[model samples]
Target chain A: MSLVTDKIISKPKIETRDLGLEMTENNRSLIEISNFDFFYGEKQALFDVSMDIKEREVTAFIGPSGCGKSTLLRCINRMNDLIEVARIGSGKITVNGVDIYDDRVDTIELRKRVGMVFQKSNPFPKSIYENVVYGLRIQGITRKSKLDEAVERCLKGAALWEEVKDRLDTSGLSLSGGQQQRLCIARALAVEPDILLMDEPCSALDPVATAKVEELIHTLKDRYTIVIVTHNMQQAARVSDRTAFFYLGKLIEMNATDQIFMSPDKEQTEAYISGRFG
Target chain B: MKRYFHEELEEIRSHLMLMGEKAVESVKLAMQALLESDIELANQVMESDDVIDDIEKQIDDEVVRYVSLRAPVARDLRLLFVAIKASHDLERVGDEASNIAGRTKKILAQGLPIDAVARVPRMCELAINMLEDSLRSFIQEEESLAYSIVGRDREVDTLNRENFKELVELMKSDSANVSACTEMVFISKSFERIADHAKNIAEEVFYLLTAQSLKEVTRGK
Candidate 1:
């Protein structure tokens, strides 16, 4: 696999077959969350939620405000650990059948395998080349030839190389809002994460820019497992292979995107996706 | 609380219902014209077909617009798809009714006896009933009612086959009545086609309500 590079320090060793999960070209489960609960200090935020996201497919999380879609997304890579009060209440989340929350697992190595793009694009106030290669630089890969190659490969992977190829040395912040978001995506790709988590990646962008980012996401899924949390039902319908609907910090329903949008098994999912309720 | 574009869906729905009403009305008028041998009523049935055709176009346009702009999902999305497909079936129903009326006009011009179209009225009544029930099933979200209508189409088909045999026999028995018998056979076939269209709408409504194929479900039986 082109995405499984040397940078991914420790690939989770547990196989899908060993986990007794069904395996297919499109449905090989890459991430499994079983009976997982989460909390923000004393307040519970996620109930016993569970689902398996397939490898190399886009899985979208959709629900109303404060519904814990983003919380669950952050848990996949332990992003919630940065919050002072956040903690796992129970259960486990595993990538390749290995518990991500395991003490033996390295957090840095875990994040290197699961990159995230924020709703707002945050460029590091450096040149575009530097932004793409920042993760590698921080890891002490300072050879000029290595950095140059990483920058080009990451930028191309992000679908931004053609737009900003002429201005490689220009400040990352100098790009348009959409270009900046793609730049952030390029930055995420620099580490060649096995999974990409995006939280409303297009909410801050214009429709045209949103379309470009969506297009990038469509192509990126070929090389990465993508999980997106979005309030936009149409965006979820357009981009995801599978869709999970959460409500009040509980997993309400999760199914194929076509089934979720066309005729969801649960009325709660139908109600939310159709804007019939909060 | 409903969304604003739901009114648009309602409008599309109303347009579809109006088209259904017009289709049923067309078939009824064509039947009445054939029974009474009324040339004026037959002409009226033929002329009013444009109304059903126009409503179908309007329903199609609204469905397309709603799908593109409203971005409906789940039940609402299914309703849009049903609207498009059911409207097409209703349009064909309108066409079949018009064809029946045209044949009725030809028979009336020849001064043929109304009894020549022996099994047609029965077929028309069965088909129209099925059509009404299909439309009702759609409006009320009645899945069983829609499934019930699919089997009823076979009854209309049987009557049409009998009519074809009877009309063919009448033609051979009396060469003088051949033209009238020929028109009756086509009219009977038109009614059969209308019933087929009605069955299609029923299947569509079944899908709209349950998202299951009536054909596939019934195929196993």
Candidate 2:
């Protein structure tokens, strides 16, 4: 980044720590991870970590790489189950009061309720309209009118409709990196998932694209319980209502994003965020 | 691990300390000029104020650069906040000292009796003490010392109020010297304002340390 030469001499406004994003009685818990421990074969990956994610809130998981932030995120949707060596060592994860690991729970249904966008934009080899309706098509909804409505609604929900409405017939891969990410987001919204999990969805894009994706996250946060895992601390500070700092597989501190960014409770969290940590 | 940006942060800290020292010197010399009726020392205080202003600009530039390039957070972020605010307060203290020197020059030119300006020396002492202690608290990160500076401001305020009343009486009784006594009133107020800036700087230090407003912290007590 080039140095900013414009001198902006303004008094710094000291903000009140609380940003009024506190989880009140109305903000019910949507996902609960209790004493959750996990292992990849014999190597333990997650310590006894626990936190309650509230509905309609954006909770960010931030830490150095290999700190189990992504591991914990994957555990929320049981995405780690795909790895043959990965297994839950102890404790349970409940989504809306239902133990997702229980034998009776369908992984497919669990995934439909909790959608995920990856670190990379993975728009399938399909048209823009086809990509948005892909989730519905898998559920055996093949009617053109129904799929068309889902395409419009989901694309609009993801803040991509205006730019891509005319390009519905174009390949999803043909869009720019940012457009592709938003297209993937539109696909996630097609299922009308109650929770949206984003894993560094803007890491690959330029600042303009990153800003668009962050704006989309801000808009989507009020309607869906959003959990984002990102290596960019500033992005976490900007987009998250609540931020959780993790280190060495242990949850260090979790608090309102304003408090976490301004004055984190833990010394380790402070060191890490301030770039003083080893 | 120390980041590459740590040096820039330390640079801003050093500049702030230097600015504090210059601001203190300005106040001390302004008072000395008044006591000795030295027009040369008074002019020097007025001229040296430009240095304090330039340092404030320099600190502001570095702070903005660090915030934009490095993206500081937590205590580092709080330090930036304090750096901006404390430097501004120091700059205002510089202005107050200059105003006092300007008024001192007016008193000396009129050949005013120095007897009417007795309380000002004490006021200047309290103000300088507060400013120095505030800077010390910042350097030492001493919370209690910063907290103590806030309370001591009342003594300086009371002295300024006394000076104002006595100067008013002198103006009424000694009609021939009313012009010089009027200058004394503003000089006393400038000292009081210097103390106020010092108190503000101390509150900023408290905020940098605890991330809590000193006013909010003491309001409960």
lDDT of 2 at B122: 90
Error of 1 at A96 (Å): 0.5
- DockQ (C-alpha) of model 2? 0.06
Q: CA lDDT of each candidate?
A: 0.86, 0.87
TM-score of each: 0.60, 0.58
| Predicted candidate 1 versus true structure: per-residue lDDT over B149-217, tens digit per residue | 877888898998888788777788879789988888888889999999989999999888888899999
lDDT per residue as tens, model 1, A1-278: 12222223364443334333233255688899999999998999999999999999999999999999999999998888677788898999988777878755566767878899999999999999989989998889999999899888988988899999999999999999999999999999998688899999999999889888888898898888899999898888777889999999999999888778877899888887777885
Query: Which residue pairs of candidate 2 clash?
Result: none
Best TM-score among the predictions, by candidate number: 1
lDDT of 2 by residue, B82-106 (tens): 9999999999999999999999888
- DockQ of each model against the real complex? 0.06, 0.06
> Model 2, residue A191: what's the lDDT?
83
Q: What TM-score does structure 2 among the candidates reach?
A: 0.58
